[model samples]
Target: MSRRSILRIAAWPWLIASLAVLVIGFREAIFLTPADAAQGDIGRIFYYHVPSAMLSLVFPYVNFLASLAFLYWRRRDPLKALAADALALAAAEVAIVYTTVCLLTGMLWGRATWGIWWTWDYRLTAELLLWLLYVAYLAVRRYSATGQTQTIAAVLSIFAAIDVPINFMSIRWWRTQHPAPVFFGGPDSGMDKTMLPAFLWNFAGWALWGTFILIFRYVLERRRQAAEQEAALVAIEASLEISQ
Candidate 1:
C-alpha cells in the first residue's frame, strides 16, 4: 500500500483495545479502588490526571525526536522528511490534547483538594510553558505562509524539547505546591498497592488511546500532504500546458 493510503484505519486494533482497557480502568477507578481516606472521590482524578500528564510529557519527546528526524531528512530525502514532518505535527497535536487534559484535570483536582484552581507552582508553571511552546509551534505552522514554516517550527520544537526534562524535573527539584513524586521520592512515596491496578490499567488504557490518536492523526496528515503535493503538481502541469 502507498504510504499515503497504507493506514487501514477502518478496523483499528488499538482503538478497540484501548476502549476496552479504558472501560476496565474506569470500573477499577470508580468502583474497585478504595478512595483516598482523606480526599474521598476527588482523589480518583489521579487516574486521569496522572496518566494524561505523564503521556503529555512523553509525546513532546516524540515530537522532539520526530522534528529532529525531519530536519535530518529534509535535505537528504524529501519523502522521508515529509513523513517525519507529518509525524512531528501529529505528535505535537496529540501532545496538546493530553497536556490540555493534564492542566484541566489538575485544576479540577487542585480546586477540590487545595481550594484553588491554579498556582504558579514550579511543576504547574513548567507544564503550562511546555503547553504554550507546542501551541506556538502549531501556530507558527498554521499561520506562517513562508516555505520555511516547517523549518522554523522544527527549530522551535528543539527549544520546546528542552522543556520536557525541565518540566519532569521541576517537582523533583523544588518544594512546590504540587504533590511530591509518587514513585521515586524516598521511602515515603508511592500509593497503596490496591491502587496500583486502577492506576496501571488507566495508564495502559490512556497510553493505547494516545497511540491510536497519534497514528490516526499521522495518517490523516500524510494523506493531506499527499493531496497538497498532487494539487501543486497539477497546477504546475496546467501552467506548463498553457505555456506550451
Candidate 2:
C-alpha cells in the first residue's frame, strides 16, 4: 500500500484510543480515585498533573532523537528524517498542552498544600523554563518559511531536550524548596494501588495521542512537499514551451 494509505490507517487507531483515554482518565481522576491524606480531594490533580508533567519531559527527548535522525542519517533514510520532523512538531505541541496542565494543576495542588499560587521552587522553576523553551521553539518555527522550518526546528528540538533533565534534577541537586518526588520512590511514595493503574492508563493514552498527532503532521508535510515539487515541474514545463 501507499504511504498515504499507511498513514491514514495509523491515524484512526490513535484517534479512537485517545478519545477512550480522555473519557476514562477524567472519570477516574475526579470521581474514582480516593483523596490523599495530606492534600485531600485536591491531590486528585496528580492523575492529570503527573502524567502531563512526565509526558512534557518525555516529548522533548523524542524530539531530540528526531533531530539527530534528521541531521545525520537522513541521506540513507529519508523517511526517518521526515518522520522525525513530524514527531518533533507533534511532540512539541503536546508538550505545550501537558506543561500547561502541569502548571495549572500544580497551582491548584499548591493552594491546597502550600496556600500559594506561585513559587520559585526548583521543580516549578525548571518546569517554567521548559515551557518557555517550547514556546520559543514554536515561535522560531512560525517565523521561518517552509524551506527553513525543518532545519531550524531540528536545532531547537535538540536544545529543548536539555530542559527535561534540568527539570528532573533541579530539586535533587539544589534542594531549593519544592517538595521531593512523590510517585516513584520519593518522600510521599506511599500511593494507593488503585491510583497506579489509573496513572499508567492515562500515560498510555497521552502517548498514543502524541504518536498519532506526529504521524498526522508528517503526512501533511509530505503532501506539502509533493505539491511544491509538482509546482516546480509545472514552472519548468512552461519555461520549455516558451523557449520552443
Report lDDT (CA) for all predictions. Answer: 0.93, 0.77
Model 1 spans with C-alpha error above 4 angstroms: 1-6, 9-11
| Candidate 1 whole-model C-alpha lDDT, 0 to 1 | 0.93
Best by lDDT: 1
Residue pairs in candidate 2 whose N, alpha carbon or C atoms collide under 3 angstroms: none
lDDT of 2 at 164: 81
Clash totals for all candidate models: 0, 0
Give me the runs in candidate 2 sitting further than 4 Å from their true place: 73-83, 145-149, 184-190
Q: What is the lDDT of residue 153 in candidate 2?
A: 78
TM-score of every candidate relative to the true structure: 0.96, 0.85
lDDT of 1 at 114: 94
Candidate 1 per-residue C-alpha lDDT over 92-204 given as tens digits, one digit per residue, 9 for 90 to 100 = 99999999999999999999999999999999999999999989999999999899988999988898789988988888988999999887878899999999999999999
lDDT assessment of candidate 2: 0.77
